[model samples]
Target: MKEDSFLKNSVLLTASNITTGILGFIFSIYLSKLIGPVGIGLYGLVMPIYNLFICLMTAGIIAAISKVSAIYKVKRQYNNISKTIKSVASFNVIWSIAIGIMVFFLAPYISKYGIHDMRTVNAIRITCPAMVFIALSNILKGYFFGVSKIVVPSFIDILEKAMRIITITLLIIFFKANSITALVTLAYLSLAIGELQSLILLFIYYKNLSKKTPSSADKPERASQLLFNVLIIALPLCINGFLGNLFGTASTLLVPRRLASAGFDASTALGMIGKFTGMALTIVTFPMIVIMSINSLIVPDLSETISRRDYYNASLRIKKVMKIAFLLGLATTVVCNLIPTSLGQMFYSRDDLGAYIKIASLSAPIFFTSSTMFGILNGLNKQSIILRNSLIVSAIEIVCLYIFIGIPGVNIMGYGITLFISSSISLFINLREVQKHIYLNLSKSNIIIFTLLSILIFMILRGLTTNILNNFITIRNIALILITFSIFIILSFFGIEED
Candidate 1:
């Protein structure tokens, strides 16, 4: 694709991601309020397991599909692309069905022993069918990404999220599913329906796109060989995903247990975990939606650049993207620190949620930067490095969670500190590896200045708003603060460009 087209695709995907993120954020707020802390806790507890299953069922096939498809598209081998998609999709479906069955049966054991909550058993079982739909959707999404048709996948994302929100709301109102188990089950079912909708939409798009492209009448590869090739590319990624997520799942599950060990009861510990994961961290990572969208769009471009041995351009792109991500992270950190209390009150109506957001916000820059670095590494085909980084960070996080959660003084905030340290370490390692290939033109002074200015502006405006408005947590005050902060953020960007 041309440079202009790449830029347009990036912008389109970013806009879609921002819209989806906003809708998802709003949905989360409504769900949290409707279900209360316990319901939120239950949902949070089930997520790691769900993610693990997804990682297993998809088996990194989506990424493998994208990479393979992109290469084929570049080589004008359209037939091979279809064969690749078909083989991967077939393999994914088989695995998803097998895994779904396992999950359906093992839900009781996992809920009883793994999570220590029987309340999640039904939710876990309900999540099983969703995996099949999710697997198919991922295959189509991967194909779209590979072919550089981001709009299809991006639109599907927004549609899926909207469907989930609408379905869940209607179900709750019409069915009055107020119990934690009922709500959680309904939530997972809505997810399944959303995936089905996305799958159907993408299938239609794929059919149309296929018809438009000329077919090479060449003979296709044998199914066995195709599957083997796909697995060669996918297995390592899948293993990396599985092991990394295994540790992450363990760490997440351990949080409440460790908190309990620190003197809290089951209910209190789970509730605290819920508050951190569901409310505080949600607010802290909201900016990542855009950052991640940028990463997604850049990966394929970076892959194409690397394929053509264009290191100079790739390095420049990395530096520019990372700088923007860094600035956004810094701005978000400042905003979070300045208005965590007000934010929590506004979003979840809980002062404690705001307090936790303050702690989590400190990790914002590291999280954002790490994501960018990881994208660069992945684009460069350094999957092993990415995997190693995940392992190292997961280990460190687990150890930190254990040590700090056991200490009475640290408690839940230990997770926040762990997040900061692990992300910093991962980013440091990624940067070191990245510099080996191309020197990153990172401006330390500019970053320092931007950080200082953002914080200074945020504090000044925060104080002014609070004094003038008096009601700090009111919607009007929050709106004024947001508008001022946004203006400062824009001005800061222009100032950096001038420097």
Candidate 2:
């Protein structure tokens, strides 16, 4: 592949990712308003379990598909690529049915033991259809991404979001007159609709593929060996994903349980969890859209470099992505922290929720860094390393959330503390891994000077400016964001690019 071709592919993938991020972020605002904090908490509590189950059902086949597809495209083996897709898709279909059956029987148990809400049981049952849709959508997405066709996925993303917004908005109005059972049912229905729309768009795009077979240069190497190879790679990835999802779901279940043990009423405990854990984290998580976009674009390129044993190029790509990610993360953290309340009020008009936003602001950089690092590790076939690191952090977080919530006076803030500590630990592990593969070639003088300047600026403009900005919330917050970003960009101008 020529440099220009790679650049074009990267640009499309990145743009699609950015579009997904923006649309997904805006959609959250609607969701926050739809259910309020308490409702958001209920949804959050149920979602972790759903996501955990989904990850288990999918078995990390999505990453395996992308990895195998990249190899096949590089080798120009068109026939085997088709076989690989059919095999993975078949595997996904089988598990989807199996999991759906399991969830059908377990819904009552989940509702009774998990959140004690019958409405959530109905929601769990309604969400069963997403299993099949998500499995197909993810597998196809991996194949398209591997083959360097991102526009279809991008378009499907926008379509899915549109369906979600429309479905949820109409359903919110209709469900208002019904029970909580009706509301949760509507939410689940909207999720299934989005997944179906995405899968349909992908299927349509895939149908056009027979007209354009792979060129001679796109033929793949040994087909028989590739399946086993990809399966080997996918095993640890599956475990990593399952553990990660389980950690999240466990935290959700444990936090509220702990809160109740600390003497809060059921509603108050749920409300506090919903406010801090639900609203703040969900809204701030928009940056994930950006990170994921870049990750998708990077994976094929990373795999290509590794396959050819171009360690230098792989190191350069990793460094460049990390440096840029750090800058973006720092900028977002400063901006969000400075005006958390204003941003929260822009959507959900709740001061307490806004406070939770501020508490979570510092976590942006940690999450961004950790996510990208893991992506790089996955691309480099360092799957076991990622699994170990993730498991460590997940264990720490679960214990912290569980023990902290059992304390006498800890409330919703305990959740924030757990996230902060866990993310920070994960970031350290990722940084250590990055250093093992890529050396940071910066001069000590330049690094120290920039570090000092940033800290000084942050310290000088800390509380007073934010207090003053609160008086003129809208304009002042925007001004602060622009000014901070401009300064950061100016400082970054002096940094050297990774070779």
Candidate 3:
């Protein structure tokens, strides 16, 4: 792939991701206001259980298809691309339908025993259909990413998020849901509706696009072979995702119980989880969608390069992705630290979230860096390594949460502590593994320079924006962000972009 085209596509997708993220973030603010903190906590509780099962169905399918499809597209094996989607879509339909049925039937048992919250039963049931919708829709998304046809999925996603907001709003107005269960169930119902719309549109677009493309001159690849190509890549990732989410689900569930053990009541514990996870962490990680948009393209870009033995460009891709992830994270850290309370009050209108936002922001840089490693490893065909490392970290995370959250004073602060430590360890291990295969042209001194300069910029911006317009939280924060990026853009053009 041409670097210019790759950069162009990345920029386009980044714009789309940021737009969708902003919409979704705004919806979260609305949801938090409507549901209140404890309700957000209850909603948060059932989501992990929902996500855990979704992982079981759709986990690595997208990455797998994207990688396999990119490699095939490079080799001009268009038939294989069609075959792969068909086979995977069929499998997903059967498998996901079965799983959805099971979840629907088992929701009550799972909610009571697995989540330890009987109130979540209906909400859990509502997610079963959404899981099925997502399972099939992902095949089309993966294909689009692999073929570099990002615009279709990007538009669809933006529309889906907007419709999601509208759907939930209408549902709430029409039903006037009073109890927490009724309200949370409406939220999940909106998710299912949104996914269904996405699935229908994506399938139509994929079909129309296929009809326009020239069929391969080469003999058609077998359905079995097509399935194998993706499964070989997808299964390891699926296991990694599934087990990682499994451990993640356990960690999430244990938080409330552990906090209660630490002397907080059940309601207070849930409220703490809601403030930190739903509000504070939500705002802090909102910027990560930028990193994710870039990383979404990384698997395909690196896969194509590696297939042609283009290790040089592959290394460049790796180095570039890591740099962007780390720097964006650092910028996030500086802003969060500079005005944590202001952001909390600005976004969610909650004073209690100030402490959580401050603490969670500390993990930004390391967590962002760690997240970039997954795409690089996938490009290197190190899915097994990803799986192994993820399991280890997942195990470590549970242990960390168990020990830390049980401590009385630590309470919800344990989540922040665990995030920082886990991300650092994951980054160290995964980065080492990646370097063994290809040398990253990473500059050590530049990273140090960048870190120090980021601090300096933070001080300068805070002095001007954070305090002077402190009363105007909205204007002050926006001005700080705009000025920070403007300076960085100017620096990049003059000196920073050179070396």
Ranking of all predicted structures according to lDDT, beginning with the best and ending with the worst: 3, 1, 2
Q: Which residue ranges in model 3 land beyond 4 Å of their true spot?
A: 488-499
The residue-by-residue lDDT of candidate 1 on 85-163, one tens digit each, is 7877787888899999999999999999999999899889988888888888888877887887877778878988887
Summing lDDT over every window of 10 consecutive residues in candidate 2, give the lowest-scoring window.
214-223
Candidate 1 regions with alpha-carbon error over 4 angstroms: 173-175, 470-499
Q: What is the C-alpha lDDT of each candidate?
A: 0.81, 0.74, 0.87
Best by lDDT: 3
TM-score of each candidate? 0.94, 0.90, 0.97
Clashes of each: 0, 7, 0
Looking at candidate 1, the ten consecutive residues that score lowest on lDDT are 490-499
Flag the better candidate by lDDT, 1 or 2. Answer: 1
